[model samples]
Structure formats: C-alpha cells, structure tokens
Target chain A: MSDPTVVPWPRPVSAARPESVLTVDDILVRFQTRDASVTAVDRMTFDVRHGEFISVIGPSGCGKSTLFNVIGGLITPTSGLVTVAGEPIRGPHPAIGMVFQEESTFPWRTVLDNVAFPLEVRGVSRRVRLEKARDVVAMVGLTGFEGHYPSELSGGMRQRVSIARTLASEPKILLMDEPFAALDEQTRLLLGDKVLQIQQTLKQTTLLITHSITEAVQLSDRVVVMSYRPGRLKRIVDIDLPHPRTSEIMTSDAFGHYVAEIWGDLRDEASRGMAEAEASRGART
Target chain B: MSISRADHAPALVGAATLLGLFALLELAIRAGLVDRYVVPPPSDVVASFARIVTEEDIPHRFAQTALEGLGAAVLIALVGIPAGLLLYRHMVLRVAVQSWVAALAAAPLVLAYPLFLVIFGRSAMTIVMMGFISGVAPVTLKTLEGLSATRRVLIDVGRSLKLTPAQQFRLVLLPAAVPTIFVGLRLGLVFALINIVGLEFLINFGGLGQLINELAERYDLAGTYAAIAFVVLVSVLFFLALERTERWLRPGR
Candidate 1:
C-alpha cells in the first residue's frame, strides 16, 4: 500500500524561484463511517513556492480534492503537517483561498457584492473594497456584469466570478480544486488563458488539481502525477514550457510532449482506479 | 422573453378562469337560477360593500382584526425564527426537538383553543397566543431546513475568508437561508391568520369575526355575506403584504 518515490532532478523550472510559501508534509486523511475506516490521502507531501504554478493530475477519486481541503485547513490531516508562510496551518487559513469544483458564488448577491464578499467580511469600507473588487472583476473580464446575479450568468461566467471573489480576498496562495471541470472545453480554455494571465500579473502561488492533461500542460510550471486512492505521488514532471502561456499553446508539440509524459505515468494508475471502482460496484450489487 | 412568458402564463390563465367563474355566478344569480338566500347576488354583495364601512362601522372592526393578525405575525417571526436558529445550531437539539415541532403542525391545534381560552382568557391575547403556538413550528422547522441545507462549499468559502461564526451567519448563512425561511414564514402566516381569525369567530371577541357572528345571529344575510367578503379581503391583503415582505427579504423570489 506504500508507494514512495523521490524527485530525480529538483531544479526550478522558472529561472527565478521564490521562497516556499506553502508546504504539505506526509499528509494523511482518514474517514470513519459505520462500515469502515477509509484512507483518502496518505503520506502525501509537496511544497509550493511563491509564484509557482503546480498542477496535480490524478485519476478520478484519487483524493486530489481531499488534499486541497487539507491544504486549505478546512480538514486537518489525521497525521502529518501543513504549513503556510512558515506557520503551522491549524484551521481555515485566510492566507490561503480555495475555488471549489462546483460553483460557489452567492446566488443572492450581485457579481460586485460577491467579489467584494471577502473584503466585506474583513470589515473593509464599501467604497474602497468595491473599487478593489471592481478592478478584479475587470481583470476577470467581467466588467459589465457587476450587477448580474449568479443565476443570471452562464456556468463559465459564474466560475469567473468565483475566481474574482477569491482573488479579491488577496490570499498569498490559491488552491483551485478542479475549477474548470464543469465547463465545456472552449470556455475552459478561455478561463485557463485568463488564469495564466492573472497569475503572471499577480505572481500568487497556485496549486490546481485537475485531471485534464492538456490543462495541466498548458497552465502549470510543473505537473505532479498522483496515483489512485490512498493517493501517493507517482511522479513530478517538470514542465519546461515558458511562462505567460496561452490556451492556444495546448496545440503546440511541446505541450503535447508534456501531456504525453505525464499521461505515461498516469495510464497505469487510471486503469487500476477503473478496476477498483468496478470491483466496488460489483460488491455493492 | 420566452421564459418570462412561460412563467406568467399560469398566472394569466388562473386570473382569467377566476373572472369567468365570477361572471357565470353573477349571471346565474341575476337569472334566479340560484337562490339569493344560499348565495347573494354579485351586485347585492357589491352594494353591501358600499354601505358596510359606514353602516356597520367596519373600519374599526377591520383595524381590530388587522391589528391582531399583525400581532400574531409579529409573534410568529420574533419567536419562530430564533427558535429555528437555536434548533439548527446543534444537531442533538434538532434530533430531539424536530419531530415535536413537525407534529405540532398537524396536531389539530384548533381543538386546544379552549385550553388557551381557559389560560389566556377571552381576549385578543388568546387569539395572538394561539396563532403564535400554532404557527411558530412551521417557521422554525423551515429555518432549520434552510440552514441545514446551506451548501457546504459556501461554508468553506466563509471559512477561507476567516469569517467569525457570527460574521459567517450574517454574511453567508442568513442570505442563503432567507429564501427557504421566507417559505416557512408564509406557511406560518397562513396558520397564524387562520388561528387569529378563527379564534375571534369562536370567542366572539372582537374584529371581523365578531361582526360576522352578530350579523348571522340577526339573520341579516346580506350583511353577513358582506362581512365575510371583508374577511376574505382581509386575508387577501395579508397574503399580498407577506408576498411583498418575502420578496423584500429575498429579492427576485
């Protein structure tokens, strides 16, 4: 059940590497229900440097989301440690923000209010926070949608609002949990491009959990491949592709190479996960 | 455009059907196909309405009934909402108390009005108390449901924002729960209005109910019919105001 691996060449893909901003050490998560005690993420470890874009690619149900929660400090790991800015992360770190897979925009609030929510909670003055929020709203290219409700926006636009809301909070790090999983490829690509552009400007450390190889290659500085349930780090593939990357770069051969390189490590795990799911289904039936 | 039109069609059809039925009834009464004693003619009802306020001094009765209804509504909201928040704050309390709250809704609370009468005595307080006891449960239950059903992801977002528990509730939980809680309020309003007016009618205490009782006792059929019409009008006005308040609390409902 233990799959321990070491990084071969731990060199920064970016020419100038910033200090480590967030660290996860030997993280383990366990859930106890009536029938069984389940291990979701086990002995996983990684670090995110400031301004680094790390995409964690895993098979479905590989505990990528659970890891995100653990990192966000919403769920404390059953064992091991998570730290942010050299502080031992205890609970719901304001320095770290999260974008959920499902849309999390407040339906009752307009786009402006939703984006301003974090700052509003901090008791920031309305005139200043709204001005700041409007800028983030514009940065997300949702300038004219300030008055629109979440119910009025398309799925892609709603996710943009979600991103803007988190970004406006000005967290030092962002933990995005399969943010584009619900959107169609076209919108996903467009949002991915915008995310890259934002990251380039803001230089916030980002950890994105995604299954899409194309997304992983296009947006990440380095892609970490994760094994199936009781998740372990299978490989960390350095994406040597240059910065300020666009969704259109996904068409390039270099991007294809990175995708294929990561997929090679993932294929075995994917098949294993599928078989495990089938066996569990059979048992239930 | 298609979506808005689709949504409004039912309302339009319902309004049209109601008008058609009223017209048919009016015609039947005019043609003497229906007994006037059984059902007053539409014109007579309208004529009675014209004289009701001044002749019966119905403005005072109307105010009295409305005041009691408002009092009952206030009690329902003030007591019910907090009770719901309390129930939802702890799973143990919710588990122990939820069934009792739900059972109160269907427990024939009307039968216990006599006991309330014995306790509160024959007054408006009895009516208001009855309404509060009968109506509070639905609002409380709905509050619990709304709060309990608030999306976990939203709570996570609140956590990530470093919101204190009070701030989380005010900013996140309250807005999310308002729409569902408004539904409970409306249900409670229906119960409160019914109990308040019904208790008045039973006790012959004050307001429209007492007026209707005195009118029927004298066999003043036209005035009785007119007074009951006013009662229906009162209920309609309450519903309209409740609808507006709900929309104000949770806009675009």
Candidate 2:
C-alpha cells in the first residue's frame, strides 16, 4: 500500500457556485508565547464544497485543532481569509454549527432541553424548539432518552446530544473536532455510522478534524492531511467511496487501501511530532 | 440493606449520640467529677429549657435574630452575587481586589463592629449591617471564582452556536457556575449568622445572644447552655434550608 495507485475520487456533488461554500485562503495563525512566537497554521488554504464531507487528519499537536478553530471563527488567523458562501468569516455565524470534543451537554438540562438550547438562544419558542430538537435527537438515534440528564447518559450518548444540539440550529455547515476521540473504538465506529447517515440525509456541508484514519476514510469524501505543527497541508487524498456509508465498509479492500494510503502520508509526520514532544519535555526537565 | 437500617441509620446515629452524651454528663455531675452550678448537667439544662422558653421569652428573641439574619442573607445575595459577577466580568477588578476580599473574609470582622455601631446606631441595624458586611466578601469572592472557572470548551460551544454574550451567560455560564455559587452562598449564610449573633451579644439589645449574656451574668449556667443550644439549632435549620434550595435550583443533582 506504500504507493497505491491514486484513484481519482469522484466529487459526490458539485457546489452551486464555483468558489465553493467555505473557502480558507492562505490562512496563517500564530501564537505569541512567553518566550517566542510560534506558528500554528502556516499559510493553509482549502475550500469545502457544498454538500461535501471534508476531513482534516494529522498527528496530535499538528494544528488540526488550530485550523479547525480558524474555520469555526473561534480564533482569528494571523493573516489570510476564510469565507463561507461568499461572506467573509467575521466571527461565529448562525449558519455554521459546531460539535465540540468535550462534554458540551449542559449538566443542568435534560437531553431534550440540552438539544433545544441553541434554538432557545436564537429566541425560538418552547413548542417549536423542542419539536425540532426531538427530530435531531431521533436522527442521532436517541429518541427515548430525551428526558434524561446528561450525567445519566453514557459517554457516547452525551456526544449524541451534543451533535443533536448543533443540528437543531439548522446550520448551513457542520464543524466537528475529534468528536469521537474520547469514546471507545466500538462506540466511535457506531457513532461514526450515525454521523455518516445524518450527513447523507442532511447533505449539509461539513468539515471534520480527526487523527483517526479509518474515520476520515469511512466518513469523509476528501481528507486533507497536515504535517507536524506549524501545520501545512501535506496532501488532500480523496476517498472514492459511495454514499450512505457504514463502519462495515471498512472491511472492503478499497477502504483499507485508502486507510493505508493516509497512514503512509501520516507516519513520518506523527513520529516527528513524537520526537519534538520528547525533545521539549527533555528541555523542560 | 434492610429498609429499617437504611431509612433510620442517619436519624438514629445523631439521636443516639445526643442521648449518650447527655447520660455521660449527667453521670459525671452526679459522681462529683464536674461542677453542678458552673457546668450544668444535662438534666439541669433540660429542666431550664422550659423556663428559657416560657419565662425568658425565647421565641421573641429567636424571631429578632432570625429577622436580622434573614435581612442580611437577602442583602448578601442581592449585593454580593452581582458584585462577584462584575468582578468576574472585569479581569483587572478581579486581580486588584480578589486578595483583599479573601483577606477580609478571613478577618475577625467583629473587630470592626464599632464603626457599624457608630454609623447605624445601637439598633438591630448595627447587627444586620455587620452581618451583611461579614457575609458579602465570601459570597462575592466565591461568585467571582465560580464565574471565572467556567470551562473554556463550554464557552467555545456557546460562541460557535452564535450565542450573544448575555445569552452565553444565561444558558451556559450561569448553569455551570451554580454548584460553586451554591457552596459560596452556604459559606456566606453561615458567616452572616455568626456575625449577627455576635453583634446581638455585643449590643445587649436583642435576640438569643442577649439571653445568653444575661444568663451568664446571673450565673444561670443551665439557662446559658440552653440559650446557646438554640443558636446551634438555628444554624442547623439554615444549613438544611440552603441544602433544600441548592437541590431545587439544580434539580435531580
């Protein structure tokens, strides 16, 4: 699989416009530390098309999260620009919803209420918000668990609530950041299947950040691989898979080839990341 | 666990301890191991409980203290919590005043009671004001802490959802900060009551503290002990009320 033939992946659907739905144009982000300034994303550029599922995969600390933050408009890049559907990314837009990696379900709220929060913030009435939220909860396979508190749910269920909450807002794009990283492998795959089903049904543009090769290949239409921090886009590998996917698809030789291909691009950078981390630790000691 | 054991264990342990201690004290005094007039036996204190209630007018005194404490508790909640939120909103204000507020919380604030007396006169106003001042620092500081300690990821979620700043506070920050704020309120309520009772004793004008002072002066040891026990009772009641409020506020937690 070291030099698997680069099969031309099909663009599942074309954007209505030429510029794409979301554009990251030469984005650069730098942090000023106590000792020195450090670059996180070095002039990164990408475009997520309408109704496309794009994944950013890299080693830990490879600025995948930083780029993700920049895309979500939580952090302003040092330079360059990001535009969603021809509008420049100013800050968080109502049209772009995000699912966080951490437990984002409000502990004080029941699952129904937690899912309804975004709509409530948007001033939607109780009857409408709950009705919409219930639909999304069902979409994530959490129908009967609506009245339960976040603490009552398992780790996987809580994440489902987070996803449902984000989806209830009816955003034009979904931004996810390692949403299943905390869950066990079995749950991750199951939830990944659920997410793929949701994406297929919604056909909403999505940009996901993950280190999971299987997840990126199984769920995403295109995977943007990044190098070690000061992250630069190393490659954009397309996963030429069919629609409405499941974890069972991973058993396919083509899926394995795609996974192995991503690992091939990621291996050296991952070890380089590890070496840098170790060197930093040694310096600190 | 059996139903009887599970249901009755907590109530029984406290009751059993009190009865055992009462018996021990009664035995010690009868055996001449302790003084009768100076350190009253459990029997003497129980005997005085009736007189302390009927003759000494414990209800009126209890009401006076409760009223002052209630007023101070209200003031602490009204002023302190908002002030804490303000402190949290302004990082410079927090850095400038957090240490001073913490030091004031730990201070023997009763030492500053003379100023309160001069300002509010030798009335219940003096005691209530003292209680307010004593309680405010802890409540404010704790509220600041609770608000400041909001999880970054939660805030990011709120922001990414396009929530306005006020909406973020209401839907996200407020709920997250509540458990810690409840803890602060508990501390503030207890602190306020201590200062209120102490002020009452100092002024000799109102409440159970005055009754304790008068009893002690007349060498009514049993009466004094009984009066002090009432203060303990009030504290327990305040604690239970706070617990109930916290549970109601964060239901099913």
Candidate 3:
C-alpha cells in the first residue's frame, strides 16, 4: 500500500540545543465542586528540549487536557509550576501558541483575517499583519482560501486555517489538544504529515495530546504516557528514531516494540479508570 | 442537491395563498354574503386607503409612531446589550440579578403604562417609555445568552494568543454575540411596535392606533378599517426592513 501521510517537502535540519524549551514541574490540579474537590492532575512533571516534538498519550479523562490547559496558562495548577524558557508561566504568554481539537476559526472572519487575529490584537499595522498572515496561509497550503469564511471551508481546510493562525503569531512552543481527533482517519494522517513538515521547517517546540498510540509513535521524538484520572506519569519512552520520520517507520520493528510496551503499561490503567467512572455514575444513581 | 428555482416554490405558494384570501374576502362582500357595514368591501377599503395616503393625517401619525419605535429600539440596544455584556463578564452579578431580570422580562409593560403616565404624563415621553420598557428585557437576555454560549475552544485560542481583555471581547465575544443580539433586536422591534400602538390607543395619543379609534368612534367603519390596514402594512414593511438589515450585517451571508 502507498504511504498516506507523506508530504513532498524536504525536512530542514535542526541545530544542537542544550536547554529545555518547556518544563512542567510536579503539577497538581484540583476542581472544586459543591460536594467535594476532585483532583485532575497530580504530581506530574515533564520537559521538552528545544526543537523537540513530544506527544502525550493517555485514555480519555486522564487529565491530559487539564495538563495542556495548565501549560498554556489558561488555568492555574492548584499546586506546582510550569515554566517556558525559564520564565514562570504567570498567565497566557506570547511565546506559546495553541491549536484546539475543534477547528475554531472565527465564523465572521475571512481566512486571512482569522490568521492575522493575534497580530491585530497586538496592534501590528494592517499591512504587516496581512503580509505575515498570507505567508502563514501559504505555508499551510491554503493560498486560494484567503477570502473564504470558516463555514465555507471543509473540516480539514478549517483546521489548516487554525494552524496558519497559530503560526502567524510565530510562537516558540505550539501546544495542541487532540487537534486531529475530530477529522477522518485519512484527513488526520495527511494533516499530521503536513504538521510534521511544518515543525521540521520551523523547529518550534511542540507538545501534542492524543489517544492513538500509532499517532504518538508516528509524530514524537518522545512519548509520555500518563495514568488515569488524578492522572500521574506512567512512563516516558524515547523513540530515538531518525529525523524526517515517515509512515514507513510505523512498520518497523522498533516502532512495534514501543507500541506494545506502551500498550502494556496503559491497558490496566485504562480498565481501572473505566471501572471507577462507572462506579461513580452508579453511586450517583 | 442543488437549490434552484424549486427552493422558492414554498414562498411563492404562500404569497399566492395570501392573495387568494384577499380576493375571497372582496368577493364575499361584493356578493352581499357579508355585511359591508361591518366588513367594508375590498374596493371601498382600497379607496379609503388611497384617501388616507393622499389627504388624511395618516402620514404624520405614521411618522410619529415610527420615530418613537426607532428611538426606543436605539435606547434598548444601547442599555440592554451593555447590561447583558456586563452580567456575562461578572459571575456574582449574574447570579444576583438573574431572577430579577427574568421577572422584568416576563412582566407586562402595558400594565406599567399607568406608572409611566404618572411620571411622564400622557405625552410622547409616556409612549416612548412604554416602548422602551417593552423592548429592553429581550435584548438584555438574548445578549447574555449569546455571550455565555461562546465556545470554550475559541476562548482558549484567544488566550493562547495572549489577547488583552478588551481585545478578546472585541474579537471573540462581540462577533459571537452578534447573531443572538440581532434576534434580540428583532424581538425588541416587535415589542416596541406593540407597546407604542397600545399606548396610543389607551392614552388617546396621536398615532395610527389613535386614528383607528377616532374613525371607529365616529362610526366611519371604512376609514377605521383603512387605518387598521395601514398599520398592518407598516408592520410588514418594518419586518422586511429588519430582515434586509440582518442579512446585510451577517458576514458571508
């Protein structure tokens, strides 16, 4: 079978970096309900070295999203800290960009305006923002869609617009929350390759949250597996694979071995989490 | 399936049905199957309509009612939309005022006319106040609902961009709130019309409703019917105007 997720562009080489771009240090998050406080993330710690692409894989409700929210400074951790470029993440910082699972291009804005939103907010001149937005849109292969609204575009196209919007800001770290989970499997693979190609070109530090083991293996230099709710770190596996990774890598022996290892670690935690959730529902009834 | 001429078939049928009803009413009166004194025949009604258009004080009454309604709509849009936005931004205030707002929305503004009359005393002010009271609640409620209904993902995207509070409100919240706010404005316009006409009738104020009352009291049944038809035509025209305005404002429509 032909490889589905291969892009035509040549991957750019990265320079050696000594320091970490992002660090999550022993973070804990708790949500207060009327009846009781629920822990979402507990004592989780991780780091992404400069120019590295990391994937986080866990079952649904494993607090991976909460971790992303904390890292992006949308929500504060009840305890512990996160720092980007050695600065404590006090709140939403300009250095980190985010793409959500749901494609959220503004319905009222044309693709170009949507992409240029961050620059417009920062008081950049209209001419400068438009020029930068056009470059990003072209990079995402959406040059002809500049004047189209989000509603006029397909799901895959809309997500591409969102990626362009994120890139227009030129942030060092890109945090994605299951950004392809909503797309069809084929579109997911194609966009996944496009994203990898973009990352190779820009060398931005990226953290991706996903549930698919294959996706984690395909994209990451390292994959961090987390346990179920009140989620704790389970294991971190280094792919140590060659750069400009391709779909052919998925069929390799080393890739199969890592997938099996991660599955073994996750299987019991997945069942336990499911049973706990069901029990909680039953108790409510 | 491509939408073409077939898509407009329903609207064409509806318009034809309305025209048929008018014809049937006119024929029934002409055939003396219905009393002309009670239901003035369509020809006589049309003639009366022409007379009102050419000679009667109908134009002045229409202008008066329209001015009051437009003024009230502006006031409601200004006060209610902002109040709703403020409530959306402040959780404690929302919780505190939600029930009160609901009660105000549900209460009949017509019943408050006596109170307004005491304050403003049976003038254009009284009519405008009635319209304002009737119009404000829906705009406020709809604006609040729209603001709250903005998707979390969009807000997350805005946060990631490090947008200031004002920037977020302008870029994300305002556009998100627009369609719902337009719904509110549409509802408010209807309410304003209803209240303005009701106040004119109740207080003997100078508007189309007052003209209807005067003609009815003088036993000029044709004139009264003509005045009522005029009111209906104005309302239909107003709604069409609003529909066009909404389509113009909606991006990519």
Please provide TM-scores, in order, for all candidate models, with all chains considered together.
0.94, 0.94, 0.91
Candidate 1 local lDDT, B23-116, one digit each (tens): 8988998899998788877677777887877988899999888888888888898988888899889889989989989999767797799899
RMSD of each: 5.3, 4.3, 3.7
For model 2, report the TM-score of its A chain.
0.93
The candidate that wins on DockQ is 3
* Candidate 1 Cα errors over 4 Å, as ranges: A1-17, B1-15
Query: Which tens-of-lDDT digit does each residue in B2-110 have in candidate 3?
Result: 4766898899899999889879999998899999889887678778887776666888988888888778878888999999999998999999998888788778879
lDDT of 1 by residue, A45-157 (tens): 88888878999999999999999988988888899999897899998888888999988999888999999998888889999999999999999999999998888899999
DockQ by candidate, in order:
0.68, 0.65, 0.70
Model 2 lDDT tens row, B36-129 = 9778998888899999999999999988888888899889989998999999999898899889999989999998989998998999999989
Candidate 1 residue B108 C-alpha distance from true site, Å: 1.8
The per-model lDDT (C-alpha) reads: 0.87, 0.88, 0.86
Candidate scoring better on DockQ of 2 and 3: 3
Instruction: Let me know the TM-score candidate 1 reaches against the reference structure.
Output: 0.94
Docking class of 1: medium
Q: Is candidate 1 or candidate 3 better by lDDT?
A: 1
